[model samples]
Target: MTDKQTSPAVSVTLESGPAGTGSIDDFELFYARRALDRFRARLGRQGLLDLLAADIEEGNAFLRECARTSDGEFNAGTTVLQARGMTSAEFLAWMDAAFAGEDERPLLAAHPEHYAMGTDHIGARVVENIGPHVCSFYMGGWGTAAMAWAEDADELLPESEYPRKMSSNLFLEDGTVVGRALIQFGDTAEGFTANLTVYFPTSCPKGVLDHHLRHYAVEFRNWIVAAAEARA
Candidate 1:
């Protein structure tokens, strides 16, 4: 007779942002922390989904890597990006286009046709200039469309998990070097949830990430303000 084994539940916690005091530095810190946590949560949730959807061979690997710590917990990091002016639909649409468009071919080293189009890991790209720190387009994920952790529509998932949508990646320059961004939509005061995760390579300075995040917040404000101006 075979003994039945049950896996432990996954626990997820999002870290808090900076304290909200009426100061410029405090405000900036608060948003930065917000972006980080939101992004992290979205990423973790997606990972959980992937783990649940893995094949036997792959599932075992994920279980080993995603094992609960001795503290009976799993720690996941996330971030947020706040862009005004655009509706959630508009923003999401823009993301889809930017990711699969021809602009990404140079960095990705292959056209959109190179992959089995419409999959999650296809020719995704991110192109934006938040502020003084301009981020070039970069390849997000490249390969099959099927997510390692996706389940059929009828499959049940844990209440703590959320289905996530991925965004294209951002590059530092026109080179093949890689950078990434992931997003999860949620309820927010600014029209839509802009849960975002932006990552840079280890070769880059940590300070660069801080600067880019700040600039990115400003960039979002600028984009919406500009859109409003265009309409006016």
Candidate 2:
């Protein structure tokens, strides 16, 4: 892995938006997006979609088995992000809009080359570039009361309800199941809290896992702020 310290920082100036003047956060996101755009250009749209489809098929089976057996070889970890002045209901509604493609700009603003296809149900695909990794996966989400993954969006609880959770099996291009992520949301006294639990194989390096924790912090913080701004 290349040392992040060795990478040159690129500064950016935003002429207009919720982010009035650019900050270090904006600069980092800008650099990451530029890198991801270069990557996408190399692969082309069709080529990337093809790879995502194959990975979905293979990764789903691997994730299902891991979930069933409580596999010991996988290490599970959680990272939580909290925001003030936003209710969980409001956040869920925003998520619904994002997943349905009704308004995905906030989501797109959260990360580099983030693409979500299909509704927030079984078989929905999400492709994201985090640092040097291009993660592709099929997603499923459910309410806390639900026992299993919903087959379609119709089976899910209304976005305004409680205990909403989304999950996916992360995969590499070759269909290797690198990890799984479960994102759960809850209402707090002041606002909302999102808990992201990830499972990675024991063989995965600590540095890699730590990097993901940092990645989640950056992207989710941006996403929450963007969503709030949109609502405002």
Question: Largest lDDT belongs to which candidate?
Answer: 2
Can you write out model 2's per-residue Cα lDDT over 123-208, one digit (the tens) per residue? Answer: 45566643344455554433433313232322233346437767665543334555667777778789977877666666555665
Q: Which residue runs does candidate 2 get wrong by more than 4 Å?
A: 6-72, 102-105, 113-122, 141-164, 167-178
Candidate 1 global TM-score: 0.37
- Taken over the whole model, the C-alpha lDDT of each candidate is 0.40, 0.61
User: Can you give the lDDT of residue 12 in candidate 2?
Assistant: 60
Q: What is the lDDT of residue 232 in candidate 1?
A: 62
- Relative to the true structure, candidate 2 reaches a TM of 0.59
Clashing pairs in 2: none
Q: Estimate each model's TM-score.
A: 0.37, 0.59
Query: Model 1 residue 62 lDDT?
Result: 24
User: What is the alpha-carbon lDDT of model 2 when measured against the actual structure?
Assistant: 0.61
- Judging by TM-score against the true structure, name the best candidate: 2
Q: Name the runs in model 1 displaced over 4 angstroms.
A: 1-87, 94-136, 140-164, 170-177, 226-232
